[model samples]
Target: MFNKTPFKGTSRTSSGYSYDDDQFASKVFGEIARKDWQDYRNTFMPVHEIFKTAVMSDDLTKQQLDRIPGNIDAQFKQSQAQASAINERMGLSNLNTGRTDISKGLAQVFAENSARTHGKERKMSAIAGANISPQDARVNQ
Candidate 1:
């Protein structure tokens, strides 16, 4: 008689007969998918931190400009110059533009990771299908 075993690791299915190849494949794929996601997140962290720094610097500059005692025209000119310098250093027109660029980059990373995970899963499924009984494969489909 077949006995169901609880899965201890990340898996597409929660429980299956202990000997099932599909169950093993799902568990292994899940682990690989999780690791890939973590790596992507880690890679994006520096970009996210740089964005945070830019926002903080912009806020600090605005606050300092507010406290300066000068003619409105002079102060406005100084603020514009400082803002332009910051934008240049940040390689963006403004914080919003930087955010848009980062968001697009993150989207691209996500798509690439997803494609990689799907490819691995398809390979595992194919291999498992070849080894499993025909009846089991038909039922899985």
Candidate 2:
């Protein structure tokens, strides 16, 4: 004989009755929101405050400012050395022909890169020193 109870619809007495998908989903989302807010308060707030203070002071040290350019120059030097070595191994002393010179091309690229990096640095410094009204400062508020 067929079991009529198994064919019946879901019932409170069933073992799966305690599980409510909507309630479980809501509870999971609530916990996730709570954790996200806690992380923002505990982890992000301190770093943001420090950066804000630094920007408000508008006093970046020389070492910090030169760090990017110094690193870039060092990398360029290393690349030039490698290129020179390769040129020597290939029996081409300068890698320059009638039309183009590798060294000159590399120098131009370096100049362009340095110009871009310095321009960005100047822009960041200007933003730090610029003043903004309260209405424009907090767009979300």
Candidate 3:
């Protein structure tokens, strides 16, 4: 049998009971929603922070790598000049050839290292530029 209880905004059951089912349900659901939101926020914030830290670390690494080629080039030039001077003073043409070969070897090594570092820099830059967020992944899904 349907109870003809008045549906007032107050917490009262249909059987004239003083129990507030509406308020209790609302409070429970509100607490659940708040807790869910808090959980989502807690999970997402750390992922965002980690992403930012990774991007910053990669940027720093790229900067350090970029300086390496210049430093190597400068050092090579200094060493080449000193070697050429020494060879001229010694009047040793064979020493000049050996120096040239060493220079070529070092140049090749530097070029390979520079290329690899540039690849890493590009990869890191792409990752940083993407600026992806955890929430974005969830939304896209």
Candidate 4:
């Protein structure tokens, strides 16, 4: 008498019989039809003809591909110039706000204290930018 056991490991049960039935399934449903292949081949066009038609009919210019490197370099240089201009403006704004000055002072103070306490003065970090702000980011007095 084969008792119904989930695993094949020999663990003694009260009625003691391991019923390990066929624990797997087969996937093959076997036999291909010749007409199916003929119909599939009939519906398809060759790659060379496809390419020929695509290139001839399309409005894509050859000069565009040739100019790719110069275009990319010009775009990147323009973006970098814009970013540098923004940074200079931001730095001047920080000097005007006095926040940058205050941060420098705080960093010095922390460094001095850390040095006095542990015999090594080292600067860690300063609060540079905000992570979160109100949706409008407006302060109404």
| Candidate number with the higher TM-score (1 or 2) | 2
lDDT of 4 by residue, 67-95 (tens): 44455556555755776688798874322
Quote each prediction's TM-score.
Answer: 0.28, 0.31, 0.33, 0.23
Among all candidates shown, the one with the greatest TM-score: 3
Window of ten residues with lowest summed lDDT in model 3: 132-141
- The TM-score obtained by model 1 is 0.28
For model 1 the local lDDT of residue 13 reads 41
Error of 1 at 64 (Å): 6.7
Candidate 1 residues lying further than 4 Å off, grouped into runs, are 1-22, 56-60, 63-141
The clash count of every prediction, one per candidate, is 0, 0, 0, 0
Q: Considering lDDT, which of the candidate structures 1 and 4 is the better prediction for this target? A: 1
Tens-digit per-residue lDDT, 23-112, candidate 3: 656666677899899998899989866656654444544454556667677877788788878888998662544565577567757766
Candidate 2 lDDT tens digits, 1-141: 854355457533322332335365566667789989999999999976754554444233333444555555676678678988999999888753443345555655666566456445654664786543433222112
After TM-score superposition, the amount by which residue 18's alpha carbon in candidate 2 deviates from its true location, in angstroms, is 46
